[model samples]
Target: MTRTSAVSLIRSRTLSDVAEYAYAATAPAGSRLIFLAGACPLDEHGGTVAVGDYAGQAARAVANLRTALADAGASVEDVISTRVLVASARQEDLVAAWQVVRDAFGDHDVPSTLMGVTVLGYADQLVEIEAVAAVLDEPQPEGAACPPSA
Candidate 1:
């Protein structure tokens, strides 16, 4: 399922039959931008989750991305863009990975780029995702006392 969010997604009407993902996204002013490290398809034990399987690795990568976003006080809905890296020259392998990511984001459909790369850092790592997200900070109450500076 797809959904909209704080980031605005843009699609080109003139572009013919492009992929389902949006072509661009824009975050609003006053939104905090979060830059995340590339999320890898690794299990909690630091082992690659999917050996030689593009789709499986992509799924793990998305889960890792979610964890990273949570750590940064964001979620998939706040994502503004992503770069998907698949370790294969074959288009089908890239598509296999892209399908998993696209579905995971549902309609949030943040702007993204998919690339077939030569290799990734981890063993048997067929997919990785690097993401940028923006989230608005919660408003302070009127006359709210400010906390002491750390």
Candidate 2:
């Protein structure tokens, strides 16, 4: 018998071709959840990188997303959902941005939503992404030694 994992992928019963997303993600019990603010395509100096370049902006935004996750003691693998906003109506631009996001997420296959917008917070910003992650709390084995405090 194949064992099913606790991460349940919920989908609409009547919907077809919705494989790209999970309508709902149910994390395992005792999971620590973190919701990160929207990450923009700004560099460390607070300036947009590669203005007017959708793919470049997407890459920067994904990099910032990784930093945010690391700061919270989480990794991309912990991400359960993501919302990607692109400041363009063109399908090609949106696809370009999405490809960058897919590269960042790797094999996690987390649920994601991509949207096209007229504008964003920054004047030259082309992409913004926000994410939610669930860090599972693994139970320590009985009688395990605790590490010393720093």
Candidate 3:
């Protein structure tokens, strides 16, 4: 079966030297939007994982993000935009986290914002990922009545 996503990424022709990401994204009407909570690098017991390691925390954060997306009936491919938070002043730390997230999305790179923050919610939490996704259902037959919300 063929697969489709609701988000359409937009690129600018004049900004060619920009990073490997879309400048913007749009979700058409009838698409179900999923706004996800920030995914943190926490373990099963609610404790932060990979303390003091940016890359390790980033990888865990990405994994948590995938799980959150699945629970929301979406995936990384359906993500329209993302905001990655790294608790550090160093660009290297941000890059370490960003590289993991960027590699996870691969070619379906959607619009993203990477930021450095002074702190995070959990103790020793080095990385967090917040995302918005859209789930699209096939268009109903023309003029068909809409289904009731659950």
**Tens digits of lDDT, candidate 1, 59-87:** 99999999999887779999999999999
Ranking by TM-score: 3, 1, 2
lDDT of 2 by residue, 1-150 (tens): 322333445676777764566666778877778899999999999999989899999999999999998787677777888899999999999999999998787667677899999999997998999899887544569998753322
Give the winner by lDDT: 3
Task: List the RMSD of every prediction in angstroms.
Answer: 3.6, 4.9, 3.1
Question: Which portions of model 3 miss their true places by more than 4 Å?
Answer: 138-150
Q: What lDDT would candidate 2 get against the real structure?
A: 0.82
For 29-119, candidate 3 gives per-residue lDDT tens digits of: 9899988899999998899989899999999989999998887767899999999999999999999999999999998889999999999
Name the regions of candidate 1 deviating beyond 4 angstroms.
Answer: 1-4, 142-150
Question: Model 2, 27: alpha-carbon shift in Å?
Answer: 0.8
Q: Which scores better on lDDT, 1 or 3?
A: 3
Q: Is candidate 2 or candidate 3 better by lDDT?
A: 3
Clashes of each: 3, 0, 0
TM-score of each: 0.89, 0.79, 0.89
In model 2, state the lDDT of residue 14.
79
